[model samples]
Target chain A: MKGAEIFVQSLLREGVDTIFGHPGGAILPINDALYDSPIRHILTRHEQGAVHMAEGYARATGRPGVVLVTSGPGGTNVVTGLTNAFMDSTPIVVFTGQVPTPVIGNDAFQEADIVGITRSCTKHNYLVKDVRDLARIIKEAFYIARTGRPGPVLVDIPKDVSMSECEFVYPESVHLRGYKPTIVGHAGQIRRAAEMIAQAQRPVIYAGGGVIHAGASEELRTLAELTVIPVTCTLMGLGGFPGVHELWLGMLGMHGTVAANMAMNDADLVIAIGARFDDRVTGNLEEFCVGAKFIHIDIDPSSIGKNVRVDLPIVGDAKHCLQRLLQELRSIDKDWKAAHADWLAQIAAWQAKYPLRYHQEPEGELLPQFVCEQIYEVTQGEAIITTEVGQHQMWAAQYYHFMRPRQFITSGGLGTMGFGFPAAIGAQVAYPDALVIDIAGDGSFQMTMQELATAVQYDLPVIVAILNNHSLGMVRQWQQFFYGGRYADSSLEVSPDYVKLAEAFGAVGLRATRPEEVRPVLEKAIRLRRPTVIDFVVKTDENVFPMIPAGGSIKDMLLA
Target chain B: MPTANDEIQRHIFGLLVENKVGVLGRITGLFSARGFNIDCLSVAETEDPTVSRITLVTAGDSRILEQVQKQLNKLIDVIKVMDLSEEPHIARELVLIKVNAGAETREEVFRIASIFRGKIVDVTPKTYTLEVTGDEDKIRAVINLLKPLGIREMVRTGTIAIARGQRVL
Candidate 1:
């Protein structure tokens, strides 16, 4: 069998049914093999779009997303996507075409040192020098990508190697001597953590994206309920705990709710499950949870004390740790509910006093928050929400109440603009019948607007709700607060009509200029069950409030 | 030993890694990417042909050093990382120094090299090439003593360390 045939077989062996990629001259052999294979390939408009789509597919389903692209420019374009996935710990395997093995270092046409280029941004990468190593490399790439903390891995295959002949034998298992992930928590550490939790007067369960990645939402919810502890999620962890639960504290970060931030500030113990203390969550590290003892549980050992010091560190899978913790807590005879009543009441008081709020008059211009609320209502909080990075993303997080894990898929760590539309398309590909919506900002949407053709071509019924404010709302908001209202280059005064663009791409387009029209347009888009773009002309100066300035303590939140 | 203050101290990290192309690049790339400085680095294949040993020297506060160790361990190509500085360890570095020693300075250079237990590797009428192996401090002292004798050319291998006990890195 040829090396390209072996590559296809290895993917099949790994249970990869769909791939997101683009074609070019260097990858012609692999493309030829793909033509005869059963694996479905979603050809993206650009290499970046392909990788983002793979991320969306991987996030929606708990499988490693896969991508294939050509050499040089194709390889360079996916670097941002690889970095984005790496930062978020998304599992994606990217295969880039390389110049023939003989000309690898000679700088042949469309050649690149992609493996070296992506060394830091990827979890691991490989340059297959021989056809004999192709199968094993693919196996290792997938293993490295989906295991442990889960991150993007790349495999650059030379063009000649793919064209060369090799015997196809897929490995049954991968044995990486240097790569071993601790799946189960240490028994003694789990016991100590349980004791700490039981003894604390005020405790908050801080969850992050790792919970969703580990499929530990059920375990997390059980532990929280059994201990009667309040739960707060990071932006990436929005749906890990049910949004409508009484114990749920809206996301705790820069734009976090007052109750969640205050609770974090006052807690005596913080049980951080699969959550890193990112700077956005813990502003001014000196003042962040200084009074609290921390118990950090994560699969990545390096992430435990990377940012903030912790009292106890449990290195293992979040699900296994949570399971053991719940068992240990159950063995103890403590009335957690009665002991934490005062703390719960205090949290309730904070929540009641200050909620996530925005103003909209009876006939005022459409607000982005209002549009988000309408999306939530129309989809009944069931849509898979992907967002580009900006004010609209924050609004969606504030307004759309996610009921389950994997429902709120957005670029959290890298905060990549132009991520949502392609990601939504990927999610739609994974679940054809489900409503996958991209709540995008105009500035971010324009970054990857060309993917509209991909969506239309695939007939993916994904809705792009563009919060069309004339300026970059988030940057403008920061400038207003810090730079004495100097907007500078943050304005998008001249922009394309999103509706016309959608129509030109053979997709439906709708416009909602007023608050009343927002719901109707969303309902119509949902009814159409096709690729549709809804242009929501929102308030130009609208800002995401309840924001603690960058590096500011939680006490310094600007509520108005 | 407990640190009296959070002063920056030199640390030696011994790492066993897969002897593959780009593995070294990955390790060095990590340090550069994280804004950490590498004071000295030496790598060579170990007894196991498939594996290589790397001795890296860096200086930082304890907290930052701890992070560096963890980050190094996180790399996929690295099999194991040992902080040789934290344990009783033997470290050595080889230095070859060529001194401009005519008849007048030759005797003094020979005495200095003998005092430092260095060997005369090469000699000419005007130059004496001496080879020395010792810890970083001894090498620094020898270089300092030979500076006034008009050193012509010098090359030094970075430090390589191993734990003194039966434990292997």
Candidate 2:
């Protein structure tokens, strides 16, 4: 068998049914091989779209999403998507074609050092030197991507390697000395952690994206119920704890809710579960948690004490460690309550005082929060919700009542600006049956706006709700708050007509300015059985409240 | 931060560079071009056909030291840069240590190292080598404590470290 054929065969063995990619000269051999292969390749208009589609697919289904692209710009285009996958911890395998081995460093046509370009972003990468390494490298790439802290892996294959003949032998077992995953928790450490949890007076659980990635939501729910400790999540940790649950305190960060932030600040003992204390979460590190004794439990050992110093660090899987803690806490101490009456009461007052309110005196524009709530109510947290970065992304994280883990997929860590539309395409492709919505801002929607063609060509019914305010509203909001209302390059006045853009890409477009028009249009889009974009002309000057001012504590929130 | 009396140690590394356009730039650019501190680097043709060797060295710890090898291997032109520390065979270093004395304590200083089997490689009537060998750590410790006693001049042959057991780079 030829090397390209062998690569295809290995993918089939791994049960990869769909691949998103764009064609180019360097990858003609692989594309030629793909023509006869059983695997279906969805041609995206842009290489960036292909990667996002793969990301969406991976998030929707619990499988590694795959993408393929040609050399130079095609390879470079996948960078943003790879970075997004890296930040969000999504499993994606990106295959990029390189120039022929004979002319690799000769400044060959359509040639770029993809492996070097994507080194920092990718979990791991391989540049196939020979045809014999093809099957083994592809297999290893998949294994690396799907295993421990799942992220994107890149495999750059030279055109010669793709065209060369080789025996198809996919490795059943691959070993790398440097890469070792610690699956089980150390017994002694677990016992010490449990002891610390038991001794705490006022304890709070801070969960992160790892909880969802580990598929430990049920364990988290059980643990929260058993302990009666309030659980707050990071941006990546949304949907890990059902938002409607009494124990859940919603997302905690710069724009986190009042109660969640209060719970974090007030607690004497903070049990950080599978979360790295990102700068966004810990606004001012010095005054963060005055007297809280931290017990950080994470699978990646390097994460512990890397950000927040831990008194007792437990490096292990969240589910396993939680289960061990449960076993250790057989004897109950429900009567031993550390006093948080004053603090909890204050938080309750805040919740009651500054609850998210929409315009009662309607100026005719549909409130973003209402749209998010209605979507959540209609979908009942069953459909996967992906979002572009900005106000809408934060609002979705805040308002959507996500019941299942991995249901709310948005760019969290890197906060890549234009991740929504193509990511939604990927999500729909991953979950062909479920209704997927790409909740995006007007500005973010225009960035990767070319992905509309991918959705239409693939017949992926991804409902994109463009929360259009006709500006780069997130920056504008920030400018209004911190930059003396000097709106510097935040306007989207020269944006292409989105309606015509969607139509041009062969998708239906709906516009909604009023509250009455939103639900009906959304319903129509959901029922249309084709790709649809809903332009929500929300209040132009609307801001995401409860923002932690620059270098300010979460306590210094500006509540609306 | 090197002391005024302390000398800098330079180690030479042989790298096999592939014959490709910008390969040299990719290799050297990794040093001067980026933040990685490179003391001294010299590249030239090697014995093997279609290959060139790059000699460079830096100082750090043995703990998590494999990263140096791994990162270098990732570069397209760099075939390998083996630390000569792994090669067996006794290697010698030339060091000049100048101790402080005013004739009263000068003989006392010369008396101490002679009994410990150290030779006075160079002398200015107020200083001597007490030439010794082991590794950088052993050399550094003696130099540090001696500085309080008065060290005027110091020179170390960087380090040409070789492995104890039989091995070749």
Clashes of each: 0, 8
Best by DockQ: 1
Model 1 chain B: lowest-lDDT 10 consecutive positions? B1-10
Candidate 2, A391-464: lDDT as tens digits: 99988888887888878888888887778788888877777888999889988887888788778887989998
Question: What lDDT score goes with residue B95 in model 1?
Answer: 100
DockQ of the two-chain complex in candidate 2: 0.07
Put down candidate 1 lDDT per residue, A73-189, tens digits, no spaces: 999999999999999999999999999888888988888899999999999999999999999999999999999999999999989889999788888888888899999999999
Give the poorly placed runs of model 1, Cα more than 4 Å off: B1-5
Model 2 alpha-carbon miss at residue A286, Å: 0.7
Write down the TM-score of every candidate.
Answer: 0.99, 0.81
List of chain B TM-scores, one per candidate: 0.95, 0.54
| Residue range B1-169, candidate 1, lDDT tens digits | 2234569989999999999999989988999999888999999999999999999999998877988898998888899999999999999999999998998998999999999999999989999999999998999999999999999999999999999989887
Question: What DockQ does each listed candidate score?
Answer: 0.54, 0.07
Off by over 4 Å in 2: A331-350, B1-169
Provide the lDDT at B61 for model 2: 35
Candidate achieving the largest lDDT: 1
Estimate candidate 2's alpha-carbon lDDT, on a 0 to 1 scale: 0.78
